[model samples]
Target: MQTQPISTIAFTVFLLLFSPPRAAAVRPPPNPLRSSCAQARYPVLCFQTLSNFSNPTAKPLDLAQAAVRASLVRTRALSAYLGTLKAASQGFGPRQRIAVSDCVQQISDSVSELSKTLNELQHLRDGTFQWQMSNVQTWTSTALTNGDTCISGFNAAATTGNVKLELKQRVTDVAMLTSNALYLINRLADSVTGKSRSNSGN
Candidate 1:
């Protein structure tokens, strides 16, 4: 029996069978505003050595540092729940608003302390500032003030998605400010060290 010539339809079928499957769609990059944040360069200075927050005798630096860390914890907590809240379209009333506002107040107080730390850190330019480490006192005060401002701003905001979005934006700003304060503070301290070394050689 003579073999039938391959038909066009058969050829088309064969080609389709050999073709590779399409790849999954690639995701777009995240929005820049949300993606960017403070460089994770941790601060390495003790404002004041205190046992704990319960001890009112602790130095402001220690107290302030504790406060910032606490605020960050709250941030994490809220971030975790925010997704669920948004998904359910859950509407928080005045009480929740007040709670968030309290958080904002805490942030503001922390920022104030950080700013003060920057100013005091600048004084680290002096060798004498090495001892007592008291120069950073003013800086601690400044940081506390800014921290308070940050917290207060959030608390004062209206209870709306728009307001919440604004609060999120402020978080980024606070992170950036914290990074800057730490960087400048270190630089100021370095300047003092260089001066000390120079004077010793003279």
Candidate 2:
């Protein structure tokens, strides 16, 4: 009998199905702002707009403007990453083929969820910083999966194409965006909660 090789993936999938989803430890929120961050987002285009004619390192006039810039930064990085993935899937070696296919699956899944979260982010900016937080968490996991896929693809192929190299670069870009998004989410939350405390004290 030609039995299938034991795969960590099969085992992991089985374990996930059986085990309970673990929850993160709850923490107090930050941000002293009265308005919510749910609708806060970076620009749909790049960070620059008629309202943002100068350097982004300089202060944005309002919270929404700051958010639009942040979202654009994240979006540009994500677009760059996808470009890399398209490039990496170019080879035909048995190993390379397998590796690239795995990356494609993960990248596809991650992007699908990312799109959903982004749509939600664009809708409102009230008490929904939780959505922003969720986007970060999802992206972090996606990056890990994409990274593993990239390494595996590289190992299987003797030589990489421009495309393959791009995939690796994308993993880098996505990780950067994930980290920055989380920092903003935390800071914004803290500011919100701090303001709430102050008003209560007053």
Candidate 3:
């Protein structure tokens, strides 16, 4: 057998013992927005509406707040548009004018409900978490109901023409946004309840 150099052998052993092990594989962090929207009733719409929302912390409450705020803004805009229709009343029949007036009121109520929801979410506290979440859910649902009422008023009035179509479209859009917001708010409530149960060993 050929003899190997002792120095070379020792150097090889040193390299084996001292070389850094291969770095462990790194994994990307979970996407908060995607995860939040995954279980929503309107996941795609929820994601799109909140895609531009600023949520660096990625907290559930932040997402809920954003959703409610978006609904509130849309409701306010729709209410304003409805007011114009009610005021002009030029082309509208008497029934349509009444429907537009009713819708304006309904949308105004929706705006208030959404505003309340947003406020509750913003001020949510651990001590009153359940109570606050209940209020948020109720208010959000009320807003959605108000939107439905607006549409129903138009239907009952037998409203026709562009005004009817335009009001229905805008109200429907607000209702969808409000519905998504309510869904997210309920999800947040569930998450909180689960955490509470876990902490108490229930």
| Candidate 3, backbone clash total | 0
| Stronger candidate by lDDT (1 vs 3) | 3
In the range 1-202, model 1's lDDT, one tens digit per residue, is: 9765679778888989998989989998753211211222432222211122215443333333443444344444444444344344336665555546455445545545554443443333334676524445445435435544544555565445664565566565445434433443344445556777899999
Query: How many Å off is the CA of 59 in candidate 1?
Result: 30
lDDT of every predicted structure (CA atoms) = 0.46, 0.51, 0.84
Off by over 4 Å in 1: 1-91, 118-127, 131-160
Determine which window of 10 residues in candidate 1 has minimal summed lDDT: 45-54
For residue 56, what is the lDDT in candidate 1? 44
User: lDDT score of model 1?
Assistant: 0.46
Per-residue lDDT value at 56 in model 3: 44
lDDT of 3 by residue, 13-73 (tens): 9999999999999998976787788887788888887887646466777888888888898
As a whole number from 0 to 100, the lDDT of residue 83 in candidate 3 is: 81
Ranking of models by lDDT: 3, 2, 1
> Best candidate per lDDT, number?
3
Worst lDDT window (10 residues) for model 2?
A: 42-51
